[model samples]
Structures are given as structure tokens and as C-alpha cells.
Target: MKRALALVLSGLVMACAFGQGNPARGVRRPPKLQLFHEVNLSTFWHQAIIRQLAFSPDSQYVAVKLDPVLGTTELVIVEVLTGKKISTLRSPEYLGMSQNDRVQWLDNQVVFLGSYYRWNALSGERLADAPVVGWQAIFNQDRTQLATVENVLGTPSYLHVYDTKTWSDKKIYADGLSIGTIAWTSDDHLVMSVGVTRKSMGKTIAGHQIGRGPDVGPDVALLLFDPQSQQFIKSLWFPARARKTAKGIEWDISADLMLGISCFGSNSVTLSVNKILDGRTFDIKQFYSDQQVKSNSVAMVGGQACSADGRFLFIKDVDSWDGRHKASNSIIDLALSRQVASFPGGKEEIASSENGQFLAFGGKKGISIFLLNGE
Candidate 1:
């Protein structure tokens, strides 16, 4: 019995001594993240960053979001084979003024999913027809039936949907709460975040700008919306005491539709990748931590795109100083690990692949493609 106990103790010591290397060691010395391809897109878009990027259904063409400061926003489509600009779709007034122009490739044609009207971002020419009020855009698996949002003025502001094929629109609303943003699940079910307008006030303690002007809103809670049943079945609340206030939460349904990532915060952030199965949502995964990433690294929001295979995610990290925010991107593979890889010149907008190929958004130099390998 003594010899057996001694042998077990010796094995335990050997295991501890030979334990795997530090698991918490972050991306200090991230491996290669090699260069796959780089293209010199046009130099017109400066201070201009890529917002949303998508590959065509056939995976031959690439569509990128172009935000040229003080200029209109354009969606530039390039042929992946030739690295040549094939087509450009611009956003119309009220839509292109800011950098929220979202250009998505559904099938053969690219559609602006955010608002209805489309315009020439460079020439300032109106592309689409009149304004599509309360209309939200969502694409099908084959990129058909662009889902749209339509605002219905009532107790609970309703959202209507329009089919891209027939141009027919329909209203979808629940009981309470204002409909903020809408998205489609993997199974083609609709989901949304519903919340009330909550206001908060803070007095000027010293001589600082103490939370009053454009930075105050009600405790924006999160709600899950179902378009089929037309109801908000679940609710999640944001932290009301943050210093910066709430900007609402963004949702990304995983490829399996069993998980999602919700971005919620004002100053300090909680970027949580959650799991939802069997009608229950659980916060199973997380990416960046406020204390670790936010404090030391540059933080920028707006463009977040996952890979086609749903194994990787891209986040637009930016730096803001004088009311202007400049951005770059990075890719994080949730499958291999919750580790991130950086591109040269500090990195901004990112788009990745399941096979480890990725595109990093470069301001004037165009887009850079690389493999997301650590070594």
C-alpha cells in the first residue's frame, strides 16, 4: 500500500511538471497569420474604412463597405480572381451621410440591407426609389428575398417585411417595447432586440462633461423578437450604471443557430458569445475583456462579420481622439480558440475563412489577405 501511494504521488508530480504551457497567455507572440493575398483597391476612400464585407454566393466576387469621411458611402465589388473593381453601388442621402451603409451580396446582385433607398456615394446620385419606412433587409440562404424592416407607428412600433422578389411588404410587431434591430436565425426564423426608451441623468461633479448631452438614454434592455409568431418572448437588460450609457446590443446568430455574440456596453464593454439551444440562451463564450483588451488595446465598433463557415469572426477596432474615429480590423477563430491575430500597421476591419484565409481592411492600400495561423 505504501509503494502504491508513493507511485501515485510520483506520477502526480510528473504530470504537474509536464503540464501544458500557460493557457492564459494571450496573443503576445501570435504565430504567422501569413499573407495569402493583397490587392491595391482604389485610393479614393481615405480615413475611409471597410464596414461590412461579403463574398458572393458563388464565391467569385467580393463586396466591401467603403466609408470615405465627409463623402458618401459606397459598396465596392471586386473580382477575387483579377483583383479588379467590377461594380460600385452607392447609398442615397440620409443613408450614406454616415458610415452605416451596409452592402451585402445575397446571390448575384448586391443589396443594401440597412435602409431602402440606394444612391451613388461618389456622385451623389439617387439609386433606389423613395424612402422605405420601417423596412428591414434580410437575405435568404440563396440570397433571395432580401428581408426588409418597415416602421409601424403604434403602441409598440412595428416593423414590416418586404420580399425582394415581389417587392411586397408586410408588418411584423409584438406587444411592447420599441424594435431596435432585427436579424434572421439559421433556420430562417426572425429575431430582434426590443427595449423601452429609458433616460438617465448625472450631475457635473467637477468641471467635466458629466453625462447629459447626446449620451443619455433609458436603460436599454435586450429582447428577443420572433417574426413568425410576431412576439418578443425573451428579455435581457443592459447595465444601467455604466459611465458612457448604452448603445444597445448587436446580435450574431452562429451558423448552427445554436449560439450568438451580443455586444453591449457604453464605455466598459461586455462582448459575450452566447449559446442558445432548446429555447434557452446561455452565455457560454466570450472574446475580449474590458480590463485586458479595452484598457491596453484600441477599441472600435461598427463592423463585425463572421466567416461563411461560422468558425471565425472579424471585429473593426478603431482609435478616436478629436471626435473622429479611425479603424482597422482583426480576425478571431472561435473554433481553434478564442485567440486573435493582428495584421501589419496595427490592424482595423477583418473578414476570415474556415480554411484560415482572411482579409484585413487597409485604408489607402486596399485589402490584405492572410492566413489566421498563430505559428
Candidate 2:
């Protein structure tokens, strides 16, 4: 009887120590964020830099591409709420020897295009030892269709379309010598970078001027097409010729609004915007002048991203031609006509939501998201 009483007393003491004062059974609440919470997203995988990131349409998951390792790149889909990894999309079998070029959301699914590889996120499949040639664009608004402008090394250029659901492909055009980037303005219409002959280097094709530089090979402009008419409607200068080198055309979206950075003269880089209506153009405004941007100096030389809603433009500073560190980049709120934020630690890549509510960047400090709450 004495031993039984002693054991019962010990059990009571332990229960009181563990369960009496704790409201959550001792689990701790996360610390509150002053500016913003440093959400720990490091547990989804091992070491590898994420090059590009995009949130799903519903904002439930974030899809990202890791820097190449073991001659292969990994695509991960992470749950936003629980911070748990939902799926990893990767394949060394298809990539073979190509590197990751770019990835974007085609509606609900993900589509990635590499040097010679094209991947479908929903089916998680790749081309079987067959490489696709040239630059491609997805309707983005519609998930099923993809437009590719191909110019085989020595052959004339051709426009092709691929239906993601059935993998059924059909060539749209085969008469052009070279094509740049194709964007679908509507289901019945497409916008493509149409180039002129090699001789039209220093002249104007339509109202758009062409550069006369020694490196000037193909002079091209953006053209709108009506699938029903099977003819070009109008052509205009591709926003910036100076900014585009081997990487092809500057960043563009098919929405009604468009923004571009162009170098007009030997020393001026201009940021211009235009709104399209009924196949007609209206110049909204030119926000930045040559004084605000400089080549090989204040401006970054790589890919830039605008918010899906087209409010903010994030550009990475290239080099210190103007005596600034040239390492850190600035985020511009075009609607406000001012630079709102700067990331100074190191060079980074940025991607913003359509509404600019959330901004994501990749840098030496790892990937980070800045939540923009209107105060």
C-alpha cells in the first residue's frame, strides 16, 4: 500500500509539471513581425539557388527552379500555408545537356522552356530526344496553346502552335525568313516580331526606325495579325532595340497595357508605356528619361520583370558606370513616378505579382518576399 501511494503521487507531480500552466501543451507561438516576418522557406530542399519563382493562380503554391546541380535543374512546388513541399518536378532524362532558360504559368499549369527542352508541368513530360528550335511564347491567359517562332540555323523561319492537352502541333506560318517573339493578343489574333530584309538596316520599315550599327543584322518590329484575315494589320517599333542583344526582345505581356525601356540615341535610355485599343495606339506617357537610366552604368543588362498588373517595374543594376555600387537594384512604382524600394546587399532577380501586392527576389541572401500593404 505504501509503494502504490508513492507511485500515484509521482504521477500527479509529473502531470502538474507538464499540463497545469501551458495553454497549448507547451507549443510556442511564432514571433510577431515588425516590418515583415522572415518566413523560413529553407526546409523544402537542399542547396541550390532558385533562379525563377511564380505563385500559382490561386496563390496556394509557389513554383520555383533551382540552379543547376548534377547537370540537372529541379522544379519544386511548395505549399504556401504549411510551408511544406507539395511536389518536385525534375527530369535529367529530358534535359540531357541543356540548361534552364525560363518558366512561366500557363493559366493553372506550369510551362518551362530551356535551350532545347520544353516541359509540361501538369503531365510532367518532355520531348523525347527531340529538341525544339527558336523562341516560343505561351498565350499565358490560356493554358492550352503555345506559339513558337522557329528559324533553323540555315532555314527560313516558321511559326508553330502546340496544344498542351493533346500535344497536337500545327504550323501557323512558313513564309517569313526570321521571327523574334510571338504573343497572342486574343484567341483570334497574335502579335509577332516581324523582321525586314537584311538590306533595310538604316531605313524605316513602317513608321519605326532601324539602327545602322555594324552589329545590325535583322530589323524587326511588332506586328498584329488577324487569324481570320491571315494578314498583318499594323507594325510598330519593338519598344527598345538597344536593350535587346542576344537575349532577344525585351520583356512583354499580352495584356492591354505595355511598357518598354529603349535607348533612343547614343546616350539615352527611355522608359515608355502605351495602351492599345481597337488595334490603335495611344502614348500614355514616358516616365523616365536618359538622365535617369544609363547603359553599362545605372541599368542592368539582363532580364527584367513587371508586375502582372503592370504597376511596378523591377530592374537589376548592371555595372558601376556612374560611380554608384551598381550592385544593388531599385524597384520603381510607375504609377507613383518614384523609386519606392532598394535592395542593397547584392545583385538580385525580381518577380512581382499582377497587382504588385507581393514581390519576390533572388539574391546572395536567398529568396525573399516583400508584402506590400498600403498604409
Candidate 3:
């Protein structure tokens, strides 16, 4: 019996030494993080309202949208290493509607939403002028196709598919459901959030209406659709209390994994990361939840993006309603299920490169980039 007990103790020590036992759990250290670059918005445009930050495919340059006070919206390209402005491209038609411009990088070209804008990287010249009316616009993996959610009033919401080469579009899905956000999973598959809003008379209290007329239901659904075949593939429903409020839902799609942030009820929010290997099976994991965040506040993931390699997820926390409050943005190592690093300040948007080497964050103050190392 003493020999057997000695053998068991020896085996337990061996497991811990090999890093294969419960003793090593929760003791793993986080990855090392370092700040690489920071670009001041005021240096490029005075009092510029920065809208979007997109890194080039090669991580050499970054595209920035600057809404100036006197002129039209400008798309500026800057060298990542030196923080020097390379070229500034302007669109006269985008003067009044600068807020709606969503810039996306497609190889050497930058395509945006307003006026169906497409611009060249080297020359800063407009390539196409096909106007598409939508809020969330996403391009496919090849940049040849574009998908957008058209939510016009008094009509059923539709998914509009466009061909970038011919500047032609078609309304593929015209269901009664209103789409909050749309993203491309691949060249053939797309994912979107669908919800419905209903109106009812509010109770009169002290000769005043107590509640708003429109009572939005909390039955939101995330669906996967095949854009090539124009067919519905699969869907996953949200919790009954998880409805989209003023700050609409946001999601990041990287290969087979999707991370979604859903804000529901008056003060409840949840972040769900789903792995959809096949169109039919969806493996979902709720990573975070906040029960105290107000409804009017922006969702925690309003400015979130995933690394292209699907190894890391970055999120900018909404610490306070006022922009002055300092918040900690986190870099999560998905495989380890732990936060690797956190940055101080309220970063409005976070983006990473295809190779996961460079990360960029944008905010009211300015934009910053970091080089991820020691993974």
C-alpha cells in the first residue's frame, strides 16, 4: 500500500511538471503587449470628426475618414510606420452626409457606402460612383461583391447585393424583419441580425404618456444566409430580454468565428462569441455580461474588431456616457480564454490586420496602433 501511494504521488508531480494538471490552471501569465504608434487626428485635420479607421491588407498604410468643418468628407491615407499622410481624397457629393460614410479596404482600393464610393489607393481618385442607400455595408472576401441592409420605413427590410465591377444591385431578401447589422462571412455566405418593432398605445399618467409608442420586442435573431444562392441557411435566436436599443448591435466575423454584442432591456448587455463551422451547427459561448449599463449608452462592442487569424479578440469598454472618462480596452487571447492586455482611455474603434501583426484603435482624442508580440 505504501508503494502504491508513492507511485500516485510521483504521477501527480509529473503531471504538474509537464503542465498537464489542475495545479497550473489560472496561473498562466498573459501575453506581453507593447504600444507601437499613435497618430494624432488634429495633426491631419483641425477639429476633424473621425469616422472610421481601416488598415491596408499589407498593414503598411491606414485609411482614415476625416469630416472637416468647411469642406466635404475626406479619405486620408497615412503611412503606418511614420504616421505621415500619404494622400487626401475628397468627395464633393459626401459633403453633407459624412457620418454615413463607412470605409472598407479592398486590396489597393477603399470602398465606402455613401454614393457607392470606391477610390484608388495610389492616385486617390474615385473609381466608381454607384450610390447605395444603406447603413451597414460589407464587402466580400474578394471585394467583387457587396452586401447591405436596406431598412426603409413603410417597407419590409431587404438585403441588397451589389456587383462592384458592373455597379449593379439587386434586392435579394425582402422579409418583414428589420436588419440591424450585416456582415460577410465569406464570398458565398453572409450573416445578419433581424428584429421587429411593434407600436402600441401608451398609458396616460397625469395627462401625459408614460411610455413611448413603439414597443420593440426582444426577439432578435442572428441568421446565416447564402448570398450566392439567395437562400436562408440557419439562424440562432437571442434571449427574450436581449433586444437592441438605441445603440444597435455590433458583430465581428473572422473566418468561422463570430463575436456579437447584444444590448437588451434597460440596463442589460451580453457578448456572445459563436463558432459556426458548418451552416447548421452553431457553438455559442457568452463571454461577458453587464447588468448595470444603461440603455442609451453605447454597447461595449460598438468599436470592436477581431484579428484575421481568429486567435485574438479586442474590445473597447464603455466606461461612462461622457467621453472624458478613462476606460480600459482589452486584448483577449481566445484560445486561453483570458485577457492578455489592457489599454487605458476610451478607444472608440479597434481594428486589426489580416496577419494579426498590427492593431489600430480610434477615438475622439486620436488613433493609435500597436504591434502584438510574444503570442
Candidate 4:
């Protein structure tokens, strides 16, 4: 009887810690968030760093990748509601971007990096290593295909596409090097973060600069491409980084790779936003009070997330140069293009469910699953 009572008490404590407190008892505050599950890497590894937390399509589970500690990494999948460990995969080294590592899911199965390994979350079944492994993998909005872009010295980056279900390399493109990062347009076309120098029909193509970012190389532009024909479609130089909305994505433009008219005073930088619905552009121009002229560049917007109703847009922006690489997020009222709330972090590992119902924040200590109230 005593042991059973202790177990019951422990469960109650966990519920409250997850923000699932009873309203009658006043256990939670306003806009209470329910913790779906929790994961602290220190429990299994002597040292752990939260690298990324990606939720499955159905939002039933989350796949977490811990940074490679002393050269070994672990990927753990846990049930969102029950906090049950479905499976775990170990990688000999870091996968993709070491700092912002990620995991991709296909048809609910979790496909991770490490010896080209794949695991099924529901069955806990592990697939054999593939013939080849690609780095810097990204998925389309529909999640039907995955693309791996590989860059080599003195050569253009190559992109390898894999069918999500069969994990087969379906297409290969040589234009990957032109892309700093990639996204999908509203019409199922691929958009790339590339600059003035480009490739069209295996020849050099250049753009007459109407605008620029910092005054060095070419300002990174969102170049649209039709993967089916492997042809370049169009390019736009606004909205530094795009996320969920407008079906258009913005790419980060490093100061070194951007150019403008008077990189001298650098008083203010103008950023344009392309709205998908009505084809309108919103300009967000701000002055650089924190940095010198040489260091002042376009405030790079990194992450983009939209609320379920598309009323609110979340933008993560870094204002200055390396003097402070810190990122900040502002909740924007889309209709007004005004900032509603501001927060400190915009660089941490975060993931949202397909349905935009939940947002997961991964930290060094653990992962926290919070219900998205869109507030």
C-alpha cells in the first residue's frame, strides 16, 4: 500500500511539472501548456547536447538527435503522450549541420543518419545501411521526397534525391552548389538561396543587380527551380529567410556574399516580404544602431513558422554580424506586419508538428513538448 501511494504521488507531480495541473486546484496558470513527453540525455550518456527534435507527421512521436559528444551521437524516438521510448539509433559521428543537426520522417517512419541507417518508430525495426549516404538532407513540404546536397571543392554541389518510402536515389542534379539552402515554392517548385553567379544549361548566368545585401559577392536570392526539368525558373531578392507562409522561403545571406550600393554608411537595410495570397511585398527596413558600418548587413531572418489560422507569423532574425550571432524571434501580426511579442532565442533546435498543433523545444538538458495555443 505504501509503494502504491508513492507511485501515485509521483505521477501527480509529473503531471503538474508538465503544466497539466488541474484548474480546480489552481495548478496551472493562464494558457496552460501540457507537456507531451520529456527527454533528458544525461540519463543515458555521460555527456549530451540537444541537437534537434523533430516530430513525426501524425504528431504522435518525436525524434530527437543529440549532438555528437566526443564523436558519437544518439537519436531517440519517444511517444508524445506517454513518454515512452520507441527506439534509439547511434551514429558514429554528427549528421548534417553539426550545430543544428536534424532528423527526417517519412510516412511516419523515422529516417536518420548514421551508417546510412533507418528506423521505424512504430515497429522498432532497423533497416540495413544503404549503398550511399548523403549529407545535408532536406524534405519537400509534402514530405514525399528527400534531397541530399553535397558540395565538393572546385566543383558545383550535387544534389541527390531519394524517394521517401523506398529510400532510393531517384534523381541527381548538379546545380546544388548554387544553393546555400533550399525550400519549396507555393506551386511545388524548389527554391534555392543562390547569388548572382548561376548556371543555366551548363553555362554561367549572371543577374544585373537591382539590389544587394552587404556589398561583397552577390546578395543571396530565392531562386525558383523546376526539379522535374532541372531548369531554373525565377529568382527574388527579398525576405532573407522564409518558413511556412507564402510558399516562398528566404535564405540567409552572409555579409561576405552580399553587395549593396553604399556598403559604407550602412545606416539601414531593406528586407522585402513576398505574400503568397495577393502577391504583395512588405518592406521591413531598420537601422543598425548596434554595429559599425563594415559589420552592418541585412538582418538575416532564420526561422519561419505560422500559426494554424495563418494569422500570426513567427520570424527569427539576427540583426548584426558575428559581434553577436544571437537570434531573436518576434511574433508578427501578419495582417499588420507588426511585431506582437519578442523573445530571446531564435537559434535553438525546434520543431513543429505537421498540423501546427504542437511545438517542441530541445535544449541541452532535455526536450519540452508544448501545446501550441497560437498566442
Best by TM-score: 3
* Each model's Cα RMSD: 14.3, 13.7, 13.1, 10.7
Candidate 3 lDDT over 174-262, as tens digits, reads: 34556665556533566665554332123221132323323332245666777767766776654334345566753212212232422
Clashing pairs in 4: 157-177, 215-258, 215-259, 241-250, 242-250
Residue pairs that clash (backbone atoms under 3 angstroms), model 2: 308-354, 309-354
Error of 3 at 31 (Å): 5.4
**Per-prediction TM-score to the true structure, in the order listed:** 0.61, 0.59, 0.68, 0.62
Model 4 TM-score (2 dp): 0.62
Q: Candidates sorted by TM-score, descending order?
A: 3, 4, 1, 2
- Which runs of model 2 end up more than 4 angstroms from their true locations? 1-47, 68-70, 93-100, 107-134, 153-155, 165-167, 184-189, 198-218, 237-286, 295-303, 316-325, 333-347, 354-356
For candidate 2, write residues 130-213 as lDDT tens digits.
234445544334455555666754345667666656656666553443454555543345665555444455655335456676
TM for candidate 2 is 0.59
Instruction: Give a tens-digit lDDT track for model 4, residues 1-375.
Output: 546644654575455555543345522222223454556655654545666667787777888777545666778887765666777777655563563235667657756553256677667677665544555566665666666656553345566666666777755554423445544433445545553333322333324343333343333455555667776655455433434546455344322222111101111111332122211221223222223222433224443445544455444455445465445555545445445566443245556666656666654466766655422
Error of 2 at 302 (Å): 5.0
For all candidates, the clash counts are 22, 2, 0, 5
By lDDT, the better pick of 2 and 4 is: 4
Give residue 334's error in model 4 in angstroms. 4.7
The lDDT, on a scale of 0 to 1, for candidate 1 is 0.46
Q: Give lDDT: candidate 2, residue 37.
A: 17
Highest lDDT scorer: 3
Q: TM-score of model 1 relative to the true fold?
A: 0.61
